[model samples]
Structures are given as C-alpha cells and as structure tokens.
Target: MGEGAWSCQQSPAILLAMPAQPASSLPNGVVQSEATARALIDAVVSNELSAFRQGPLSPAELAAQTQQPVYRALRCIRKWEKMGVLRVHSVHKRAGRPIRRYALSAPSFFIPAQVLPLEDVAGIVSRPLEQQLHAHVAHALREVVGLQGSEVFLEPRRYGAFLVSAPGQVWDGSGENLPVLANRWATLKLSYADACAMRDELDEVFARYADRAGPQTYWLHLRLVPETSKA
Candidate 1:
C-alpha cells in the first residue's frame, strides 16, 4: 500500500453508495440497458434477492440501499406496483400510521433477459447471441492477423495486464478507491448504473479511435465477475 493507494480493509457488506437513478415510469423490460441486464443476471446467479428485496422492502428500505431520496424510491415502487411486478405483502398500523411492505411476485417477474443459474454455465453451455459483439470481435481479430509486417502489437509491456485476487473470490469489493500506481492492475467495484455508463463511454472512445486514419493499434481487455461463490 503506497501513498494514495487503496487497500481492501473494509467489510464485505460495505456497500457502494450511489444517487438514485431518478425513478422512471417505464414498464419492466421496456427500458432495457446493459445495467438492467447485468443486475438481472447477478440476481439470478446469486439465488438471492436483490437489495430491492431485503425483506419485503418499503420505499424507505429501498432508499436506504440505493441512497436515493425517499420520494424517488416511492416513485419507483409505485411504477413497479402498477406494472404488477410487486404485490403488497402486508400493511400494518404502527404507532397510529399505516406502513406498506411490498414483495416481488416472483424473482423473474421484473428481471430482464434472465437465465437460470443451472442453464448459464459459460463453458458448458452455448448461448445464442443477442447481438453482434462476439462476431465483430472475431472478425477484427482475424483482420489484425492477416495484415503483414505490422507494428500493431510491438512492445508487450505496453499491453501487460494481470489479475490479483484471493483464490476463491471473484473480486474483493473492498479494494482501494484512492488513486494508485497505474503500473498495477486496477480493481473496481461499481453499481450497475455506473457500470453501464462506463461501458457506453468506453465504446464511444473506441469509436473515435476507429474513425482515425492512422494505424496506432491498441488492445484492451476487461473481465467482470461476481464477488462470492462456493459450496
């Protein structure tokens, strides 16, 4: 841990705080984005409820986890309710006030692009592509290979990268947040929404590079995996 470097010295339950995503009125599955897909995939794979279901959560409960304003949380709750994705689990009169608790009708009721854990084994299963990213990446790799006498991949150190992790973990979310040596691998923990924005922004950067007329090639690789797994 050098100066300004972050060390994973926090708890596993230490959550990543985020501002509310301005509760939207769209129906489930209507406003699909990579973030939504990622969250859905995460929830399914975890076999656990999302923060939204930290036990029949009220808007306040959701707000607590999301760090969203209470009003925004209420808007999101109402939207899901109207979509019939959530059901009133119970209502109680507490200290002269009524409180409502809502539960997801089914885990899959509102999730987008779901694949059951049993059906989602990456190496053992072959999934049909939902888009062209895989095909295009393969095409690009072949084209790079065919070009003769190219300096595209010279200086291996410029492209050097590796993983650092405990043997049984996908990632330690508690990893450092402060700036560190750029020469080392960077570990990040981001909310689904933030992750989505990073993906889109990076795509834009790559698009700009593709439009340039020169041959200064680069390779960037990233892998995202969950934090915990085991028997």
Candidate 2:
C-alpha cells in the first residue's frame, strides 16, 4: 500500500482523545449559499452520489461506493470542505501520511426557497425521475407481452399535466385480454376541511402501496397543486 493508504486497525483511545466539534455548531442541514446548494444538487441528481449522507467516508471509499472516479470524488470533497458543507470527521496516520475522512457537517441539507426559484428547483429534481419513468415504460413495451406496442405520452392541459397511456395498433388489433388505461379528469370545488380530508385519504392510499412487493414495478407521480389564473 502507498503512504496514503489506510489500515483497518485504528486506536479507539486516540480517536476518543481527539477534540470533536459540538453538534450545536453545525448548520442544522440548512444550506444558504447558492453555489454550495447547486454543487450538492448536481452531485445527487447527476451522479447519484449519496455516500456522504450515511457517515464519514474517505475519498477512496466514496469512489468505490458511487462508482465515481477517485479524483472526481476528492475534488467534490475538497470543494464541499471549503464551502463548509463537509468537515473532516477524523484523521488516521497511515504509513507516515494522514488519511482524512469526511462527513456532512450537518445530518442533511435543505435549500431555502428564497435561494432558488421553486419551479426551477422542481424541474431540476424531477428531470431524472421523468427520464426514468419513460425508460421503464419503453422497456416494458418491448419486453412485456401485455404492454407490447402501448403508447405512453404526456398531455399538458390548461390547469394541469396528464400522463396518458393508450393501446397501440398491435394491441388494439388483437382481441386478447390486456390491461386498460384509464383517462379521467374533473374540476372540483371543495371546502378547506374537505380538501384536507381528501389529501389525508390519498396519503394513506400511497402509504399502503408504497413498499409492497410485486411481480412487476410501476412508477406514479401525483401532484395536487392549486390552479391559478396564470396556470
């Protein structure tokens, strides 16, 4: 191993002797800087890197876990360290060189709405989910006999967006039994209490099916935003 290599053996007494930062000193996971927020978002949404959320990890460990290049991981760690989003959790002496482990300064991060536009942030976060949904539908159409030749599309309405799926020519031509896609929309007028009750009911339904095991997997995106004149 090189001078920077770390060993499994660590002295508990030495580790315990090191002065630790008080928990109260941390940022409480709220990130204010736009640059740091953007960097963290990019790391998550783009690379799917989330090792830092678990605990302190060396750059090499992060690279191995995320499948990112070691240099890239180190670069991000260094950048975050400078931005105060990450801190050195501990240092271990290995072959006369000190190996540092980095962890999130806070347990998690929250970007304030004032720091970035809600619409832009939502778009950035939802892009990957949209892509994944499309890819899954495409794969199912190719591989699943029942869903073969089905069409999935998005329809943007005046007040809301709709994702619709329809049987294609092949499926329509065949009289064999297959799953049917439902298309329905309605404008509702409800009191505050009724709206809250509806929301709670929907949440319960979601929670019930959120983790169920199934032979096939599906994705669902539900939004219940208020409709405005500009919408």
Candidate 3:
C-alpha cells in the first residue's frame, strides 16, 4: 500500500481527518470529472461481460447471452482482443467455415504492482460466479484503463480472488455515488505527481453530484498484473 492506502476498517476517520488536504497530492490525472466517472461506472456495473467467458460462442448464442445489444457486444469483444485481455486462437476448421473460438491471453498490466492490491480486488458484480470471474476482469481493466486510480492487472485470475479492496483515503468521502466519477479519473492520461495536485477540484466535482455525501468509506481497488515472471 502507498501513502493513501489504508484499510476499510478505519478509512472513514482517515478521510475526515484529511478533508482539508488538497487533492493535488494524488497521482497525476488520478481523478476525473464527476460526470465521466459516473458514466464509466454505470457502464461497468450494468455490463453483461460477467456472462462472457474465454470460450466459443455462436453469433446467436453471444447475442442471447449478453445484456448488451449485439453490436456493442461485438465491439467490446474486439476491443478486449486488442487490449490483450482476450486471445483469439484460430482453430482448424473445415473449408469455407469461419473460425469461431477464442482463448483469453493471460492479462498484462500497464502499471506497477505498487499502485494497487492485486491480492484483494473484487469485481463490480454481486454474484459469486460473476465476482469470481467477470468482476476480476472488470476491476483490472477499470484499475488500469479507467480514471479514478491507475493500475494494470498483470496475469490471469478471477476477479476478487486477488487484488480487491476499498480506496482507503483516496475516495473515502464517496460511497455508491463515486465509482463512475472515480473511473473517469483513472482513465485520464496524467502523470502520478500532477494528479495529486488536483484532488480538491475532484472532490468538489463529486460533491456537486453526490446526494448528501453518501456513506464515507474507501471502496476503490487499484490492482495491477505484472508482465514478467518474478522470482
């Protein structure tokens, strides 16, 4: 854990104590505009990727199994492939038949492990199955690619199995109302040092959209998977 990395058990008190502190101390571009964060969170929490696995699926099956429209699902699938989150293996097939199966590549992280707790992260989903799988993948992507916090998931593993925890003091004042906003911050492309300087502005942005400072607790998990094997 880093300077802001505390446990959920005492996050509220830590948050209040640090209220006067400037958000500028956070990593560069770590927080985002409130509106964008909310959009990202909504897209994530309501997404049907929880239902998808690194397996074969017919076009009809893919359409029926996901919560998103076929177009969006197709688009997301392609994006995941490009991001190295999914590996599409071309299985040998009969002539004239299209290959229709994919294997997920072990995930790779764009950041360092010090950025997040890879061993304790959980998915955004509520069910055990989703939490174990899709949730992990979602959090990893959100941590690495989204805004609030910056992290990169390193390897293959189910969500929440490793690297899940609250944000501690980072988003302490925000509860359910802050995920989307936080995600936006993570997605922004700022350096860690510059991001720390804008914390107050980020907090204020959240305040404007929040309904009564909804439950103060750290719930953001910054997890990263390493690219190379460690001894």
Candidate 4:
C-alpha cells in the first residue's frame, strides 16, 4: 500500500494518534469543504443507523471512513445529539483509553423510513437555486409523466429565495424535522410539535403559493410520500 493507504482497522487511540489524511480519498462526489463535509457526515448518520445498530461508529472509525477530522465529526454528531437525532452510548475502554460510541436515538419518529433518505434530501439543499428549481419542476412532472414517486417542494418569495424539498420515499412521519416549510408567509424547519403546527405551517405557506386549495394550484409539497408497499 502507498503511504496514504490506511490499514483496515486499528484501536481508537491508535487511529486517533495517526495523522489526518487528505480529502482526496473521500467518495468521488463528496464535497471538499469542512462545512460541507460536516453536512455530509450528518446526511450519512441520519440515513443509515449506526453500523452495529447497537450504537454509532466510534469517533475514530467515523474519521477514518469519512476522512474528516475527529473534532469535526464529533461536533456534528453532538449537534444531532442535542437535536435528539442521536444519542451517545456508554463510554468504553479501548486501547486503554475512554472511547465514546454514538447511536441514533430513535427512528426519527418525525419521518417515515420510506421517505427519501436524508443524504438525498441534503443533496437537494446543497444544490444551486436554479438546479433546485429545475428539480422541483421535474418532480411535479412525474404525475404528468405517469412516474410513481413523491416530492416535497417550497416556494419562498417573501423570504427572498425559494426552497424545495423532494424525497425518494413518502412513508409516514416523513415531514418531521424537514429543513424547509412555509405557511402563507411564515417559514421554519420542521420540529417536534403538534400536527396542528405542521398543518398551520403548511397551510399558511400554501395560501401564498397556491391561490386556492384546489388541485391546479401550485404549492410546495413539504412532505409528500407514498405509503409503503406491503411485501
């Protein structure tokens, strides 16, 4: 192996002790920026449960796999933990030092599993406005084109920029904690709250985007998902 090549596995302490690697090894499409990398890490953690399902991968493993710094990975993980998106399992003794493993707290009771994975959703947010608009319009076209799919979209005129959200799946609980939602004129990220909150938020935004509640009108599909097909 070349100097840059990493061993398949190592103790947490040993892994941490090794120098940081350059960003070149990340998956082809990964963004090179740290801010972007942090978001990518969030996307990764949100969609896939921790590797063992017992808890999240060790901090070392995350850094190794993502090629991000240990502190950077931990920072993003900590934020999600605060948002109740994840939880830390008990600290363990590894390489004779304390190692903390994190894990998803619960299947975001907020969105259903069938909804598009968060990585896909994040991909949508990370795109340029023109691209986002194009993607949104394309989704609406699906119904016209006879394609089977669901999409979440938003138009933010008063807020200065339009927001669109689309998902690959529309399972139950998909709307919870969504990054973009608007009602009439107000907007906010989806939160853990009453269904009335969701309706109020959606309705208010729709009033602005859609002239009326009728079908022909256009309103952002904040969280449209198809029911899971029972196999």
* Top-lDDT structure, candidate number: 2
Q: Per lDDT, what order, best first?
A: 2, 1, 4, 3
Residue 112, model 4: Cα distance from true site in angstroms: 11
Candidate 3 ranges with C-alpha deviation above 4 Å:
1-44, 67-69, 90-97, 107-231
**Model 4 misplaced stretches (Cα beyond 4 Å):** 1-55, 94-97, 111-231
Report backbone clashes per prediction. 0, 0, 49, 14
User: What would the per-residue lDDT of candidate 4 be over residues 21-47, giving only the tens digit for each residue?
Assistant: 222223332333444434433343333
lDDT of 1: 0.44
TM-score on alpha carbons, each prediction:
0.31, 0.66, 0.28, 0.30
Worst 10 residues of 4 by lDDT: 7-16
Tell me the lDDT of model 2 at 32: 79
Question: Could you report the Cα RMSD, in angstroms, for every candidate shown?
Answer: 18.2, 11.4, 22.0, 19.9
* Candidate 1 similarity to native, TM-score: 0.31
Which should have the higher lDDT, number 3 or number 4? 4
Worst 10 residues of 2 by lDDT: 7-16
Please write out the lDDT profile of model 3 over residues 1-231, one tens digit for every residue: 323322232222211122121122123323233332232223334443333333554444566777457677677667555544444544557789665554333221122224322232222122333444446556544644323553344445411222224332133323343343333223355555656545555555544554455664324433322233562
Off by over 4 Å in 1: 1-49, 94-97, 110-150, 153-231
Candidate 2 C-alpha lDDT tens digits along 85-202:
6788899998986889987676455667787565656566567777876776565445435433334444453334332234422233233443333234567788878877776786
| Model 4 TM | 0.30
